[model samples]
Target: MIINKILNVDDYYYDVFMSISESLTGFSVNELQSTGLADIYYKHILGQIEAATFIEFLNTSKTILENSYSQDQLNNAINAEIIADPGMQDMANNIITMWYLGTWEGAYVNDLSYKEGLVWNIMHAHPPGAKQPGFKSWGVKPVNSNS
Candidate 1:
């Protein structure tokens, strides 16, 4: 059938993502949501790795062009490195965050250098049992040491 090729491509894409996510996080895509970052080693580690990997990838790509490496070779190398890097997996999670946040109000990549730490601090610096400042106040978290 003419549609078979497209259907197979869709299935292949889903299978690839599912297998990779499961290997990295030990949770299928469906299972990872609603789980606290702290409770999941793979998810937590992946996030950090992803950020660092992307930063490295940008530097590497720049270096390759500066050094006059063949564009095709450089592209292949970079692709391989990203696939092997756990950090890229973590970056995927954050990319999802960026998507969820929409356009970021015209903020550029440069803004991230200044803004990431500030946002991180504000999100995590709340007092014990405190509701996040901008988020809805759900009174008193139940007794969970991690919370």
Candidate 2:
């Protein structure tokens, strides 16, 4: 609750993150939210992303979205090299990585938990060391997808 009060992160931030997530991962907001990815991403951003850069990214992204940019345009804007500062770029990259990997790779890597990682969700495979696939699972195709 303290973080919620201190961050004052509203639905707008989550909406912006969802839009960016959809653009980056080609996944629907509903799908991401259903897996609790949205909350995970938001918390990661709050804890790791620089506040000023995050706010700027959100504002710029919201403007681009409101302008009715095509998916390609959205992607281009989100991935644009407009962020000149290294710190901002790191923040941006961290957000993108979190969506794909489902874990934040920050200064303190140990803070990330394999159980909650997103890589397994994307790979449709369990975390390598933490959870083993059931017996003989390796012999057959992965249940989620071939890839």
Give the best candidate by lDDT: 2
Off by over 4 Å in 1: 1-9, 32-139
TM-score of each: 0.25, 0.68
For residues 1-147, what per-residue lDDT tens digits would candidate 2 score against the true structure?
434542654657678867766665667778677755566567667777556667776676677677655767665655563345565467666766666565567432233344445567767777777677788977897676647
Residue 62's lDDT within candidate 1 is 48
- Backbone clash pairs for candidate 2 read 102-118
Off by over 4 Å in 2: 1-10, 81-88, 107-113, 142-147
- The candidate 1 region of ten consecutive residues with least summed lDDT is 100-109
Candidate no. 2 TM-score:
0.68
Error of 2 at 64 (Å): 1.6
